[model samples]
Target: MVHVYGPHIFHTNDAEVWEYVNGFQRFMPYKNQVKTTSRGHVYSLPINLHTINQFFGKTFRPDEARAFLERQADKSITDPSTFEEQALSLVGRDLYEAFFKGYTEKQWGCSPTKLPASILKRLPVRFNYDDNYFFHKFQGMPENGYTDMVGQILDHPNIEVQLATKYRRSDRLDAIHIFYSGPIDGYFDYEDGRLGYRTLDFERFHFDGDYQGCAVMNYGDASAPYTRVTEHKHFSPWEEHQGSVCYREYSRACGPDDIPYYPIRLVEEKALLAHYVARAEREKGVTFVGRLGTYRYLDMDVTIREALDTARHYLPRAAARGHMPSFLEKAIAC
Candidate 1:
């Protein structure tokens, strides 16, 4: 089966979360070794020691590389205000422009200068040769794929899986509580402007054999139309298929029918989100959850982690007949 929404990698530091998933599905050992095509050559991703050495033509020691980066970094910007400034300060101009600038503009459909510097805080810029993508203890893909895992999860008697069901805000519900994972704006019938989101268009094609030889290959140049190419077969290396399926991913502004992939969360969206969040707080019997619900980009682990926390939160309230808050500490973290 294909991951129609694109590759969902499981990586987390939370021990309980790791154990939680393992109980449902057998996870195969997998490490996402990402590569990026910049200019005429390909380089290792997350801009690590190997990437740095390859890009700059230097085999500097750890301390030497750190010192070199310090020199390259823009020391003038003591307090970075934007994503561009933050990246420039972290990896310096040449690396930032080559690896981040064009790619970021393509991904977000805006100048990084307009994005908050906090955006880059989660991004890892290592002085070591670690290219594992995520620096988490547990990282792997479900042996039978996510669809199967989800099917197993919903196997409980009380849960009835509903597809092709449009959830109308006006619909009268009989449920004691609600956990909404749809777009926050849609929940309120878009009284405020629809929050900006980045949706993906995939150019899916089949290849007889290996395609990119890797799971994900990023295109860093603005000249390229798409952000990355994902070869699905490589994701589950434990099993082998002679054939391959690939997707050249293109990101654009989300529309009414399009699935919201990445929330923009720019100045305009943030203001609208603030209003929607305020409305959600006042909303009864509902708790906004997940990426779309919270209007933020979140990994699968974070989303699941929050969902677990939400359940734990709702249990006590359910027993005591108390009010369950709209946003908990975990939800707020999203």
Candidate 2:
């Protein structure tokens, strides 16, 4: 079996998801100190008060900080629609160039101006000292690590996991219900052209001691090729390791052979996705779930919550021999 560590920090408002994750007894809580490297300087992420003060070299108070940002914001962008417009409206040109422009371009393989404004909506600009990356009430990772936790979850008697097995369209399994979590386009053999995605290439290296002093360090310079560097050792701070392993992550447009990470829901891709969704609805006895199945990028918490909800929806339908509607109804909008 190939084991992959779940590097994402579990942070969400969903109580059910929180309770489920905690039940694993591997909760390792830590405040996310995400940093960005740009032009030989390091700054806190999400445009917090400290970052704002440091950027302008002025230790402004909370109220002053708010006013300072308002002044920095581009009043000309009265009705911002694109990502670039949204950034200018929120933080003005300097901060956008220093932080968002290069990183966004690197991650998406497109100019920020071409992307949707909604992409920047989740990013918060706080006028407080709270440097936590996510504002969610619960924030942490599995103690023993995600691979072990997932192994334990799969140890249940009811679950049957077949590792390294390939399921093709030609293959048939005897089952009451099927929850497909693979790529939606792949299910229909990409009759409509394949949707766009951004895949990552991790260049791993080892260090004798702590490197970068954080779990994730984003490179925001347009000249820098890679998007971020992630230190694996920092992920599980509860454990001690003499050496550290880090990955300089590079992002590129995904090809047929590459593993898809982030979905690129641009105009053309969305049109393709719509065609696939219509085809999925016409099909029978298969319900799509998870990110790739629905053609939307989803965080770990939302994915798990949706999976649990999908199971709940499936049970009743399975008992009554009724149809299970695709759990991700809003996937197209994503």
Candidate 3:
């Protein structure tokens, strides 16, 4: 199954949320084992024992490997502030330059020093040989794909689907409450300023045969113009296909016309984001939810969990014709 945008693997530890989505569509077992092409060699991601041994050309045990990395790490960076420092402290200069430095610069359109350490916190450095990308309890892909599952969820008699309509603050709708999932800045017509975001451009092509032999193959070389190459067929391994559909992903600063993917929460953006959040808190008759509305990078399962929580919180108030709160749980930048 090909993703219209890019590959999204649904993995979460929330059992209730997992059971809830399974009601709509069947999910086949899938684990995302990402690969990175660094210095003309392919390596398993998360910087595990396999990668460590291969890179340094040594047979290291778990404890030995951990100690080796400890030695390699820059002990001087006692208080790591930036992502670069964090990586140097964790994997040392060699691994950081190999796997993180170049790819991060390409993806964010900024140096790793400019990014926060929290951005690199998502990546794990393991001692064991486990190649699984995530540590989540439950991981899988929708059998029929995400589109079909979303369609089933939206196939309600009361719900209406509007196409190609732009939202504005001035437009009034006949509804008791509103859940504004659009951009928090856009809702206010960018009155204060636009928050920074990284938008992805996908150059899609069809291959006569298997492409890259993996779902996601990242390029860690700074020389490479693009970030990664995704082969669609590798995503759904249950279904067999002779040909493959692939995409070369390029990440850049999001413009007014581009579709934003990642929220670039740099110092400048955080200052700008604070203004928008304060403005949203004061507004009434609407609630902000999802990644865009809150200006945070959230996984699908967490998004669904929050959506469910928001709905439960809103229903009683809607029934009694009470005033709706702007946000059930607010996002604050620290």
In TM-score terms, which candidate is top? Answer: 3
| Alpha-carbon TM-score of each model against the true structure | 0.96, 0.95, 0.97
For residue 168, what is the lDDT in candidate 3?
73
Write candidate 1's Cα lDDT for 128-226 as tens digits. Answer: 998999889999999999989988999999899889997876563777888888888998889767889999999999999998899999999999999
Model 1 scores what on Cα lDDT? Answer: 0.88
Off by over 4 Å in 2: 1-6, 331-334
Cα lDDT of all candidates, in order?
0.88, 0.84, 0.91
Q: For model 1, give the 10-residue run with minimal summed lDDT.
A: 325-334
Q: In candidate 2, which residue pairs get closer than 3 Å at backbone N, Cα or C atoms, i.e. clash?
A: none
**C-alpha-based local distance difference test score of model 3:** 0.91
Model 2, 237: alpha-carbon shift in Å? 1.9
Question: Across residues 130-222, which tens digit of lDDT does each residue of candidate 3 receive?
Answer: 999999999999999999999999999989999899977656466566799988898998888899999999999999999898899999999
Error of 2 at 26 (Å): 2.2
Q: Which 10 successive residues of model 2 have the least lDDT summed?
A: 1-10
After TM-score superposition, the amount by which residue 78's alpha carbon in candidate 1 deviates from its true location, in angstroms, is 0.5
Candidate rank order under lDDT: 3, 1, 2
